[model samples]
Target: MTTTSTYDVHTVRAAFPILQRTVHGGKPLVYLDHAATAQKPQAVLDAIGHYYRTTNSNVHRGAHALSAEATAAFEDARAVIAGYVGAARNEEIVFTSGTTDGLNLLAATVLTSAQPGDEILLTEMEHHANIVPWQMVAQQRGLAIRVVPVRDDGTISVDDVASLLTERTKVFACAHVSNVLGTINPIAEWSALCQANGTRCIVDGAQAIQHCSVDVQALGCDAYVFSAHKLFGPTGFGVLWARYDFLDALPPYRGGGAMIDRVTFSGTTFNAIPMRFEAGTPHIEGAIGTAAAIRWLQEIDTTERIAHEDDLLRHTTAAMTAMDGLTILGTASHKVGIISFVVDGIHASDIGTLLDNMGIAIRAGHHCTQPLHQRFGIDASARASFALTSTREEADMFVEGLAKAIRMLR
Candidate 1:
């Protein structure tokens, strides 16, 4: 459990069984798509299996023993996530499907507080999950939506954000890390600025949480959202960490049995902070799995893990940048463990396919950030995202496969 041995990358890789598996005629699977979805460790998988096999029951409804046990496990998961994100209280953590679901929930509930002509501010570097929801809300309520521009290097300009902020700007939603560019935005600074401007800040921490430590209280954001799957947990479960007062004031996002205090022909009253947002049958097993995963991550030394990945990034970036006709996107000084690039005269899909055949799995396309891609005048790019389990050999394999693909295309 203790990784005291000078950041052993191979030791970490050994924990994930799927990493050794082969595809494409016995070729080793070199997974480089951790940003899209991380492969689960055996600990996470076993935790999930353990939940369904042993502690399977509905939570927070019945007074039965099974329900009590299930509720304890579910709430324990909430506490663990709260601790991970540095939430002030467990009541501030609301469970959702994932980052997209968390964002949509915010859009739905928070927009109810907005009046017509109020602006919702977003950045150009947002993924579609962040962009589309705000667009829908803007369209529905006739609220003006503004965008804070990103610099050529892919970092959001604080100056542009300051200029864009007006009294009418009710909410400012930004990504903590750019999925395509790997740019780490100044969330803490932006959060402070939004606070001064009387704007609520909602941060998408799906990528950032995995790369670095996230403390929601320290970041000073009104709400921070991330997915469990991205943090080596089960899919279909995520966390929405909101300020306690904000969570109390905001209306319920979904309507169902557990979220209501009373149901009558006249109307229904909603429950308190966390429970108010979580409706119907919750993903009890997923929540337990998430807690287990968080515990597993907490067992390792994060500082060393981050340092190891940083080294991998530097190595990969150097190798890729040296290649002829390769253009790396998002050269921000501050970045996550992701590299996105396009080879000249090669379609991203082609690059991805060729790499896949060589047992190097990567993501291709605009990576759900068409606006950001349009800014760079490219259709799409090949992305290689690393995790704690990634190795130097895997990074080298990606660069080697990409070089071969470029030659094949030419």
Candidate 2:
């Protein structure tokens, strides 16, 4: 991958109005926290606002013109999203609240397929969403949850995954990119291993979607999951994409209005595929905003933009690494634009507080991956994540502020 790109960061930054605001005492806001959630772009906000202003109506089963317009926009969003993820069919995309909800739905589906002694293999670097859902499922069903070890560099090796695979391994759950480490995982190879052993491969793409090019079919996983907000869209939206066979076989997660085809006192028939999984009145504006975001993404050169992000990350990493007493947590060779670190003799919360005063935004604490932090022998780390809208100046400011914060704490 090229270190430099012609991708215009300033132009992209202008699209996000949040970049214009000053956070603390009139200092320019340097948002280095995209991993937690991204700031919405004007195009996305406009699309959502336009929908509410012009086409605010319940979708499907409506004779009104507004409902017809809303339904078209909504279903079109599904097709747009499905195409973005390289799904074979739009019906494969089932909307959820976010990646957490998607995991819970997958957890529920996999539960029905697993027996008491069956095993679910999870990587040690997984976020709590991927971990807790399976933990709950294992407790409910008579199944076991096995952990795949993460290396010192915040990556799970192929050998580690291979050693964990067994006949009873029903589901091999993994992340496309480490949310904490930012390491790009070898999902295709891992999925191939799962397929060889008759295990279901489910990949969490919550972190990967915005950073790299992702093709669900190319990854060769049985299922893929991600949230829209991470992709520069609205909150309260996520997507779960599974094979047609799995969607047909997996039971509904909830019983509700849109998900049921027929309901009788004795029995009930559920809706088909995507609708079956999407039980209630879905988030109409969320879908519209997500589709808008995808369209905006398509309009730009994504490959170039990703290269630009990498450039910013490499620069930031070098600058942060050179600082005295500041140790970056995840040093994996392959990663997105994430820098998680802890300053010696300084609590992470204190660093965060100091950075906030300087108009710098960085995340502190376990970052929702407590196990990963425990593995590193620390309770928390300060994280500064980057997105396409992020600029080199912001990275410089963050480093300068962090150094000052460390001196203050000492």
Candidate 3:
């Protein structure tokens, strides 16, 4: 798996300062937990610091100069994010605390509109963020929940999803990519199926946006949600992109100072599409830093970045596959740069602990897809995921460390 493209991974690594730091008794850090959250670059850090240093003011309310500047920067960031995701308009991109906050907000508002006996479709590979919110809504509203099963190969068939989209299905929520398996779900096909069945298609894109290109308009999904932290930006901020018409029809998810059109003793009218959902003081610096991250990533060639990650995935997978008594969990033809695996006669936690002592960071346990783990007949799996900044050297280090751990445990 060689890449012809000239992607300078060292340059990419230099951008993230933490990658240079040694950890746990002076060992070089080999970060393979990117599926959990990506490390931030210097540009993102500078953007956040600059905001507090110079333009520290509330957005969209005050008449002062600082307020106006802050508002301009905030909205400009929104436009940049909207363009990145192929949104129809900036108004359609609603800011939330994170992917979890956005999905919970959707469940509490839009999904709540379903009547009793209505069906909500989901998949087995969904993270708890996607599952629990819908479960809570279904329980409260008397809506029935249906799940598309994950096959033995860790992929779900488009036909299987089509079979589950019934006339009673009001919402079909699925992940753009599985956090554990790295299987890239066929979102466009599923979205089309939901369209014909008159169901709202909701996508959890927390894992997809950073690894590959995402176009909400091209996918034709009703809504897409993702987090900034997963994209090398600050935590506690994300975007929920939806059709403007759909957003305009829904009532406000929360009530606060910035989300009002008019307020009186009688009744109050709400603000516009995005602001209506973003109640109270928003994460101002978080939005600005996210924009910086988006710009930094865009500066790199997309083809080269993706190819670098794929190369790492192939190289690592080949090395691990040749090792005895180890099984790769997901064999989906379509995948991102993630590998979940388990060794014979060893607990995933023990593997993680040993890797930590070597200054290698990998996720151990269910990876937030407990049902997916159950589907595989395992309680947990160890995951080593890659990013554009990850290197072959790091992959080799991780493999050597894993082999040593296995020998010691066995």
Candidate 4:
């Protein structure tokens, strides 16, 4: 067991004012919806505000001083984000609206290279954002989409994936951690398997980036995608890190002012690897906020933060296990700070509503992974996810709230 210092949690929570706010008729807010989107700290908020106030100008077009300053700040944010993800160069990092946009870009670009018989491999536990785009591309390109089945425990089997791969497999897209099941996939081993089988691996890191350390190069993945909102940053911003050679080979997803080299009436040459993908003006302030969010996380000892969340998870798990009619989902040995479960004789939405009345925010429904819910023979689940600022008291309150809701419903 990792021993955590109490002061770290206290100090970290203090930086997030939303965690201290009261809601729902003056009740204290117990936010357990970090998986969907994390609340930004003061630092991130200030960074966004500062950028808009002081350096509010369009990038890469104007020759004015403000344009230069804004361009520098935006590129600086890109560099910071690249460093945080352990990418070798900032040119390899492409900013998108969110993870969905990043995945869509990859699907669209890679589809151009795929032929009628080419196969794109995916896992059963993928989010709709990761699944739907590829399906659309496959339909248009006459490509085959193969799904790797998950075990009864909700974790994907590498052997099943190995069996599905062949010489025709062109792309292997999967999630690092399932948003619904909280199962952390074996990404490194899976990437190696894909490499051995001549498949390009794309990892959806939306759920994994907030809880664990992510190093794109170290993971040996062809591409990695994650959203900033899930990591205590602003929405409308995400990252896609790809190998330079692969990114260079792929055609541009979009073409516009910033992504062009020479625009003639007959033809137009595209820009470099990242700029080729970034077609228009991006979310400038969002990028600044994301950089600030990463800096804030870097300041904290990640080991301690992980340990704190694990303690809360353990306590919550024990309480859920003690309940007579409750069945917890996703029993992967390695998971992050998320718990999804169903109470007997009650719908997940009812539990979510009851908890909301008590100023506790949780998520209920398929969680953007309807196929996963169907696989488990469940319509939905109530999820309570934690973060660095979550505490044991909040976990206890969640359990109590659930108990109250169960009894009332019964």
Please report, in order, the local distance difference test score of every candidate based on alpha carbons: 0.90, 0.91, 0.93, 0.91
lDDT of candidate 1 over 1-410, digit per residue (tens): 13454877787788898998999999999999999998888888898898788878899878898889999999998998999999999999999999999999999888886889999999999999999999999999999989988788878788999889899999999999999889988888999999999999999998998888999878999999999989988889898999999889898877887899889999999888799888899988889888888888888899899888888888899998899989889889889889999888889999999999999999999899999999899989989999988888888888888989899999
Question: Candidate 2, 407: how far from true, in Å?
Answer: 0.6
- lDDT by residue (1-410, candidate 4, tens digit) is 23536436778999998889999889999999999999999999999989888999999889999999999989999999999999988999999999999999999997686789899999999999999999999999899999998787778877898899999999999999988778889899889999999899999999999999998877999999999999899999999999989888889887787889899999999998788988889888888899999999999988778888888888899999999799888878888888999888899999999999999999999899988888888899999999989877888999999999999999
| TM-score for each candidate, following the candidate numbering | 0.98, 0.98, 0.98, 0.98
- Model 4: how far residue 245 lies from native, Å: 0.3
Clashing pairs in 4: none
Top candidate on lDDT is 3
CA RMSD of all predictions: 1.9, 1.3, 1.0, 1.2
Flag regions of model 1 displaced more than 4 Å. Answer: 1-5
How well does candidate 1 match the true structure in TM-score terms?
A: 0.98
Any idea what lDDT model 4 has? Answer: 0.91
**Weakest 10 consecutive residues, lDDT, candidate 3?**
1-10
Candidate 3: give its CA RMSD in angstroms: 1.0
Residue 382, candidate 2: how far off, in angstroms?
0.6
Number of clashes recorded per candidate: 0, 1, 0, 0
